[model samples]
Target: MAADPTHRAIEAVFRIERARLIATLARMTRDVDRAEELAQEALLSALTEWPKSGVPDRPGAWLTAAAKRRLIDGARHQSMLERKHAEIARERDAETDMSAEAIEAARDDPLGDELLGLIFAACHPVVSPEARAALTLRLVGGLTVEEIARAFLSSEAAIAARITRAKKAIAKAGVAFEVPRGAELRARLGSVLEVVYLIFNEGYAATAGPSLVRPPLCAEAQRLARILAGLMPEQPEVVGLLALVEIQASRLAARADVDGRFVPLTEQNRARWDQLLIRRGLNALDRAEALGGTDGAYVLQAALAACHARARSAESTDWARISALYDRLAEVVPSPVVELNRAVAHSMAFGPEAGLRLVDDIANAALLRNYAPLPAARGDFLFRAGRTGEARAEFEAAAALAANERERDFLLARAAACAP
Candidate 1:
């Protein structure tokens, strides 16, 4: 049976409000797991009540209030500490008694600090770095375990266990659930940025879905980047990350066709790209350079993206400059993935032979063994070099490894095109 419209609306509201609600509840409960449960309880309450009486004018506030009341009740029943119970009761009563207009205004509040704190907490050093990304996506990006699993190419069970362990580790370590300051902020910022970038990359090209793009996920990551930039205006890397996502997001419109077919960056219509985002990204990039973040990993990546943004057409792209930026990026943050990308840039700047040689050098790297993009990129170079048989084989291998349906289809089509 089709889901009721009311229920669908409630689901949509919950998905949008979930991260904020959990952040607020985490503040109140001082326990991430409890906060999540409380948020779910609020969602269940909304599903039950919203249909009975039309949805509230401010559903987010209504959900927050519901969660707060549940918190108060749970505290009253479980905590023998009168001080805790009284504190919970007072907070609940204060918010629940607010005038509708005041409640609306409160809801309109930026969620700047609260959400940022939750993000930092989720990415705390106490959690394993991989787990940190998964947890941050869950708590701050409002992604589900299944979605996160797909993003990471892991099983749902593994992702769930990783998140559970991360929460437990944070609780046991008594990690502060507040944004760090001074040197501590700088120390913690890298992990936080890593998580945000992971979220954006997943949305930019989803790992396992019918659709090539997940707009909501991309928007959430972009919003998080902007929030981080605001909270740490002096941090050049943070600003660079904001710039990177802005420039990359500008291409979302042209990344796919009206029929939802994948469009390679070189083939995407430049006019469809959002000029406003490109301008914002360039302005932010200038700010990063002014702040002396010219060599930062994100800044280098942003510069690479800027190369494309500045190009009037694919033929006009400064591939040589992009290759140089990727060289600098690899120096700042060396990895097989960076090498693979660098190869592509070298090919564009030089020739298919140059790129193919680079790809062959890393073909044996364990990290790229099952990574579809490795073979897929190599296939492109080989095809351009007129090695159609080898290119077809590589494309088939990439298609076999692809998890996203759309990406797999694109790879298979490339394989077919290479047939004699």
Candidate 2:
């Protein structure tokens, strides 16, 4: 069955306005869960009434008003509870004197600092990193629990439990719904940025999905990163993250084939890449560097991307410089993923044999046991070195382990090409 046009329009508007809607409601109600519920209630009202009444001049404002009414109704019910009836009644009386028009005015404040405040609050230190990320994506990115679960390669039940526990933790710890200040702001903002980038990276590469890219998630993360960059233009890391995502996303068009099969960087069509986005990324990188942030992870990653952007062809790429940048990035971040990427740079800088050696070492390391890319990289190197039979086996193994259908097909095709 086809979806109603009105419903689709409401969904689109809600996706764009969801963060602000929830933020304003959370500020008023002081309960994240209730704010979400009220927002959903407003959405239901829109679906019911908008068709006959037609879309409003300000759909967001209309939704905000409906959600506020729902909140007021819920508060009235709370006033009847025996445990804190007196306090609830007093608060209700105070709220009665405040007109909905005034409340709507408050919600419509163009500054939207509340949205940023909500981001920091959702990513507060009281919650675990995983929980913080889950909640932020749910509340800010407007992603469903199932979508996040798919991104994390986990079950929907597990993601649901994690979000529940996160909310409980926030309430138990009495986390405030305001933004942090000074040094605390800096620290907490890093977690927020990490969550945003994690979502973008998942969408960009889709570690476990049928498609090579989830363009919606990438676009959403880029939007959030751009918002953050605008909100805090002085922050170097904010600029760095924006630069990194912009550059990476510029290559999305050429990252896959017409049939949705994966295309490695060396084989991608450079003309299909978005040069406008590349220029924006370079400008953002310049801003970060001008602010004296040189060695940060995102900044370094952007620098690596710039190397590719500058090259007219695969052979023209500055492999040595990329290897050096990877060296710096590995030192700063020091993760298995960074090391894996550094190996690729080394391979490009030297020879397939040099890359094979690095891949071999990583293969034996217990950490990459379930990582499909290790074998995939090895297969590519072997294929380039004229070891077709060995490459075929490796490619088949990679295809078997890969979760994404597009990547699996690419590997399978490569393996078939080596057939006798």
Candidate 3:
């Protein structure tokens, strides 16, 4: 069934402008919860009004103005009920002027990056890492709780509770709703970048969904990365993170086929990759290295992506260099996941047997016990080594543990291929 064109247009406008709207209101109200409610009211207003009247030429500004009016009306009602009515009445005119001026300033001034402030607020150190990502997706990415849950492969109720707890943590900590400066900014950046990359990874390979990729979520993450780059041009890690996302996004179009089957990087047609994004990524990588970010975690990962981007064919790729880069990445940010990836790289550069040995070493790591990728990588090595029986069992195990439908299907097909 075809969706209503009008509704689709409205939805697109809301998705693009939602962060800005929430940020602007948050700045004025100094209350994230209240700001979100006002933003929702503005959206409801748009749904009711835009259909009757044509969509406004400046929809963002229109939404902002609508939310502003709601804020004013709420203040007016509160003033009427309070014993301090006289005090509130005296300040009403000044409050109205300030709200308009701030909204306008946010639109014109580069320094008034409200969305960045909102992101910093969501990524406050007080929030748990898992909850930080969930809250950021809700407030900055404008993803619904259900969408966030699917992306994280968690139950909707759990995601909701995490978001609730995160908001309370922020309020309890009395975190200011503004971007930090100097040392404070540096301290907060790591958390912000981690959450942004987490968002991009979910979009790169949806954790649990019918679709293999979620382009809108990927775009949102990239938008946030680009915002960070603009605000901190001198931060090498920031630039490197931007480069990493750009390079990864270039392969998005080729990640799936006409029938929506997952296509491995080595199997994808190189010509289908976005050349513009590849160039952008490579340029950003060069800038990061020039700024003395050669050994940063993000810089190392960008270098690894660059190795693939530079290759005309998978066979021509410098697997030796890639394995070396993975070695550095593991040292910089050790994890069971990195070990699993390093094993794959070792297999590519050396042999299936070499990779299999590495995988076996980490096979008992607690984190990899139920991680589908662990068995999936093992299955690939076994298949390449002509151990069909073992390969099939590993693939089947991976499929059983998989959360995403598309990924499960791909693994099951691999298992079938290992049959006699």
Tell me, by TM-score, which candidate is best. Answer: 2
TM-score of each: 0.77, 0.82, 0.81
Off by more than 4 A, model 2:
1-16, 41-73, 80-101, 104-111, 124-134, 143-162, 360-363, 382-393, 415-420
Model 3: per-residue Cα lDDT over 239-291, one tens digit each: 99999999999999999999888999999999999999999999999999999
Candidate 3 local lDDT, residue 388: 92
For residues 1-420, what per-residue lDDT tens digits would candidate 2 score against the true structure?
129776898788777878988987787667899889999998889888888998777777788878877766665686666535346446656766345455567566655678887887788778887788788889988889998887677899999999999889887877777778898888887888887787788889988767889887788789889988888788888899999999999999899989888899988899988999999999999999998879988889889998998788987999999999998998999877778888888888988898888777667777777677878788888888889999899899988999888988888988999865
RMSD, one per candidate, in order: 5.0, 3.9, 4.2
Total clashes, candidate 1?
A: 0
Model 1 worst lDDT window (10 residues): 98-107
lDDT of 1 by residue, 1-420 (tens): 128887888889888888878877787678999999999999999889988987888788888878877887887776576687777666765666654456557656564566777888999888887898789878877778888887666899999999999999998988766778889988999889987887788889887778888877788789889878987788899999999999999999999888788899999999999999999999999999999999999999999999999999999999999999998888899899999999999999999998998888889999998999999999999999999999999999999999888888889999999967
Error of 3 at 26 (Å): 2.0
For model 3 the TM-score comes to 0.81
Q: Ten consecutive residues with minimal summed lDDT in candidate 2?
A: 82-91
lDDT for each candidate structure: 0.87, 0.83, 0.88
| Candidate 2 lDDT | 0.83
